[model samples]
Target: MTTTLAWIDYLIMLIYLAFVLGIGFALKKFMKTSEDFFLSGRSIPAWVAGLAFISANLGAQEVIGMAASGAKYGIATSHFYWLGAIPAMVFVGIFMMPFYYGSRAHSVPEYLRLRFDEKTRGLNAITFAAMTVLSSGISMLAMAKLIVVLHIFDAPFASLGLSSEWIFHASIVLSAVIVLGYVYLGGLTSAIYNEVLQFFLIVAGFLPLVLLGLKNVGGWDGLRHSLPTGFTHAWVGMSQASTNPLGVEVFGLAMGLGFVLSFGYWCTDFLVVQRAMAADSMTSARRTPLIAAIPKMFFPFLVIMPGLIAIALPAVQEAAAQPGKAATATSWPSKGLIPAEAEKDPKTGEMVPKYLRQAGSDEPLLDANGQKQYAYDYNLAIPNMLLHYFPTGMLGLGLTALLASFMSGMAGNITAFNTVGTYDIYKAYINRSGTDRHYIWIGQLATLFGTIVSIAAAYAAAQFNNIMDALQLVFGFVNAPLFATFLLGMFWKRTTGHGAFFGLLSGTAAAAIFQSLTLPAGAGPGIKGGWLANLHTFPSEMAQNFWLAIFAWTTCFLVTIAVSLFTKAREDKDLVGLVYSLTEKPREDHLSWYKRPLALGIVVLIMTAALNLIFY
Candidate 1:
């Protein structure tokens, strides 16, 4: 499909860029101290903080990844939201926010230092700092790649006599510059404000696409009738790993994704929690993630439905067939018939799917000789829909929204990196004591360092298969087992610092071992790259992740318990407010019904359960 950007679209995009930069520069007066720069001086309201909480996660990679997974796995991909995210977000808001807020720690790692020892804090800090930078780089890479693939800047670059290669490099650098300008000037406050803006832009940009796509697909009833069997249901085929599109059994989905990965990302991951921590009050902080969860429950419709609609488009089918020339259209479709399977082309001996290819451009992959190549590129799902459905001005707005999401993601990581590096690593270890001005300067420097490193890492991420796979690998390596240490330390008062530290070490090692042993050979460097012998083959990557997390959490839970029994424990008084049992719970009987955390949590759970049943 051919689409061109109009001058009006360029105007809209330019206005957006200026407005974002204006927000960043305007907030510079607020950056008076490290606390203000890092935590917004702990005064952000619950609703704004809640929007930022979700927007921090609404990156370019996440948008593309959600749509890609939706196309590849159907409604089963909603597992990432409903089962994998909502409960964990609720848990963080209701049970974990007390200690996080009451302790007054600048970062999550700092909390570890107060609860455990310097060693536990050090491990988490280094790991988290590294993860943030890497994730930032990935966001940068995804944006650059999208620009190249969608030709978002091609016309302007061509007018300026610039090559595609320059466009690629310029796009990455420009994104970095834009994100750094805001984040460095206003710190976390600027990032949070822009995230709220980005969230609205995303909704405004994509909601139309969903509405149009749904209309084209004949609405909800049409969608159910048009999609493949088992595609619409969330849990009907989850009894076995092989039966479900997610390729994980009910046990694995519940424990691994619903519990381990969900809790790991929401409760412990600083990316989202940083927003919650900046809330004006304990009540607001607790409500931050809860409010974020409300919209999250419905996000799959905006991000994933477009992918489903793309499959039904004639252009997508035509591109997959690669009609005429060296590539002949093999088994072209008839009206009202959606091809569900593929057969090898007799002449070319290539496996051409009868339906839409899952990945890449609607156009078939071209070889060096300009011959059509048969490869499934599911990542092109959303981009294809934009090109096909959206007009010039609307397309520009959608692309601008996409760019905004990328910048928001990058800013989120940069802010997290600066805070963690300054407070957790630099002040705690390098300087011991620094003035408020000195630390704020250090945070600015950290932002610069993070931006440069992320630029480098974005180039590295270009070598990965895709963003979604790269993230899954990171989770298996770090987050799967990391949650175990936090779970024990926060709730189990007897858990020693040594037990917590060693248990974390053992759990991470177990995850690596499980992944390395099961990962197949020649799976590439980042995605399931393994050094040891391949011990087993998993039904899918998600299945492997489920089992890997299960093992990691189980190992850490057992090890922490066993090691704590043998080691010296801290006194209960020292653990007051940090440990759940020792901390006094706030009485909510006097509070309004809707304002109570437990009441809100129960409502969220009930709504989530109802969604699962409806889809099931």
Candidate 2:
């Protein structure tokens, strides 16, 4: 039987799509030139830019990933949101925002060119473009996978004796096409405006899920009773062997990677930086990230709390009782088993024996090996919870919010790609003589091309084990070193381009080696049996991976600084300007109330200490 979607659900989604397209069409007036298209005519207000920045950054992966982590690691996972991201946002607001805004660079790589040389700028631009495309593709693919699992659309083909896999493939293609169309129409302006709408929808849809889920789980007392000892204890279930491969301690691996990756993402990524750059003035740009930081402080409640509540649900408990059956039903194609036809409910038109359907009050769920499936797949937990808990009409709103996340993220990536392609690549190398109109056309073409490539990449990324883990693994290798280079460049002027380049390369190489050699296959020995392995297996592995990257970055920085001191300096005019600019005093009058860093610092300290205390 085919489940009929409620008209209200369809109407809500249609309205959202229309709203997004309307913004894109309206923003065309601002798109006469490439600058306007890619950077919102460089006149976006601080508040809009800030909202867009948060919206773009909070994609489906983040929403889903945080919930997943909460299920896997408990409240400790909150550290990533609070201690890791918030401080980085504040740092960018106070320090990095001014530098980027003052430079008036269209992209981060353009800043690199002004700070270093053309080669560095070109390399950074290419790397940023490549990473952005890959990440966006993976994110889109994951979103599609989630929708498929939720059975968002009718698998009519399945009912017609066709495979549901085709349904999955179609969903991905259709979503990508819709996203690319609007992004090509209007660049950052459309993206930012759409993001504003998405931000509200996501928050509105998510909060109820948390509250309702908690109530269903018997509130705080029931949750505590149902969960294992240490479930509420921030650090109760954490295992170094499972979560961290290098056996690094929590502070060393988690905190270090959090610090490095957060800075790299918030400070260095053009997706976020473009928003700051689009602000009207340096002060506005500076305040944008700071304003964004405040909202971020509350994200753990929205993202992490739901998953924690999910674990206590009676449905999840029933599923846990029948491991073998549950595993067989829900298992993906990777397990080398052909999927049996789904059984349908005659009245509801929903699949009756859907793998993730809630267990009857009397039935018990089983695990893969015919035992109780006590531990859930963290990745599947959130989707399973949502599908079971939400009613049909509310389900439409939830789905729209989820799609909004995907669209906002995709839009952000498209805008960043277009900005770098137009300003950094086309203007810098292909056609220095091109007019603003010419560059705008180039950006549109680039956006279209990027979307196509991202869709393909998304399909390929499906082969990976977990979406969030794949993204983090990629970031660990590529972004960790960039963090080092940016840090050195900002604080240590003596650092040379050779240092920056080599540091990034070394860091990436080290991270790759650690990932390959140290990360165990499935469940392997806790790191090569050594004296260090006994103390803590997981953190040690994580630490090894993180530190290797740090070591590579630091080694590169030192070598470059030492080499540059002995070697002759480049006669680059922009490099000279960068050096001079560092020495100038701040323009005092332009400073707003937030210009003082003390309040931000206090907030950062409180959040950091709270996270640590909770985890400890």
Candidate 3:
């Protein structure tokens, strides 16, 4: 699994580290006030904020997991982008940005307070702050694990007579310090600027890999011939749950991933919203997500093609020479470009194969050939692909880009955590009367605190990965119902705080109950669900996740409506600029058609739809 890196690679990483820190120090003069530190003084341009928005999400999962999914699910992996994110990004821009920008709320939970009441905001803020910290920590853990897995620090550790185990700890500290240094120095501005840098770094890093991969597989035509029938088509055999690699039918895919999960994260999650909120103007805020949607539409080609090539390489083709051979241990991971888990040979003191295990169980997953499945190490799909194509210097660039992704994710979470902690938690509850300067100091302190906590969380993640995985799902349960609260509170002027609060609780409960009752087809009792009664079986764990979101959204939506019918509504005059009906629509007449949010949004949707059709 480990590859030797040349001096050029180390130099590239060192250069990248220098620039990341340099950006933070360069922006230090701008952090005079609290607004500048936390909100970037709302001075960011639309294009800049737009790239930062998507890049904020370009963490380990976006870069690594998506590529893994690309290999696992084939072209259908684009659905996570084209189907799930594009619409939600557009919706947040034209429809949702007005209130977020106009209401002058400092954060999403603060908007909750303005729209509903203190208790609702308090609940969201507390949970969000906690989740943000945990998420950041999870990012930290992922970065460290990647470092250990890649053996990036093996030489240094060995030189120092240090145990290999120190690599994980060192990776964690190295990431935390870098993330903390920048965010602490320039706050969101530094994070945003660095995110923009990271975005380009990733693109620069991956574009060539994709090209090389395409060439290696003899281009798209060869790819098509080499891959399985459904692998090349995104929408083929998608009607039935059993037909496609995704395992979800169209209704479930469209409604669950497309609507509930997508809208919940994009429309309501403060992490990405914070990027837009930092934009300099109302027009810029609305345009932020719209601009992000442009590149977002075609990202699969840039980020996913390598995975396809990884799967359709020459070795895999040879393995399938016997018709209907299907993937086996030898060819499953493209001739061990993706490695199987390894153990030590006790007699020879050499490493041996450690068969990958099924989720939530001790049993190793076996393919149709009765051979143990290769490489549950999907995390390395993109990494190994880069190693396959890139030479010494370019390999350094690619790995640096990988490192950039980890930093971007960490910085994004930490920035959101500091802002919410300062504005929603501290200002609202802890120090309601602090001066702007005092709060700015607190904000800086909060950044440091958030980083430390994240580091701790990273260690916790290392100690109890499965528990951390479950905690992430638990947070998903919390967020699954959130869009309902946002949707109703914005559109309906009659929604009450009590309705929003209890609706959220009920939705979370519904998600938990649903998860407990259903299990994925081959999964066992545990985080993969079915602990309650196993009343229902889902086609896959992804399907279970989607359905859980669907149930949660529906429960919250209906409960909020019912509760609001008997609860007191805020007066129309008091709701101005906050409620959609009560507020005047944002005017775009002054700007050109392409410059307008609606016009750009329409174009984005059209392009996205066209992609779906072409791929379908």
Question: Pick by lDDT: which candidate is best?
Answer: 3
lDDT of 2 by residue, 247-281 (tens): 34555545466676677678888899898888877
Ranking by TM-score: 3, 1, 2
Q: What is the lDDT of residue 508 in candidate 2?
A: 75
Better of 2 and 3 by TM-score: 3
lDDT of 2 at 98: 61
lDDT of 3 by residue, 1-616 (tens): 3366777888999999999999999999989889899899999999999999999998887888888888788999999999899999999999999999999888999999999999999989988999988988988888887776666778778888999977888888889999999999898999999999999999999999988888877889988998998888999998999999999999999999999999999999899999999999999999999999999888999877777787776543221211112234343333324544456556887554566678777688888898776544555678778766777899889989999998999899999999999999899888889899999889889999999999888888878978888888889889999999999999999999999998999999999999999999877788888887899999988888899999999999999999989888888888999999999998889998999999999999999999989888
How many clashes does each candidate structure show, in the order listed? Answer: 5, 22, 0
Q: Rank the candidates by lDDT, best first.
A: 3, 1, 2
Model 1, TM vs. native = 0.90
- In order of appearance, the predictions have TM-scores of 0.90, 0.82, 0.94
Off by over 4 Å in 2: 1-4, 155-166, 235-248, 316-375, 463-475, 520-544, 570-583, 588-616
- lDDT tens readout by residue for model 1, 262-332: 89889998888899999999988998999899989999898877766766555444333122212245454
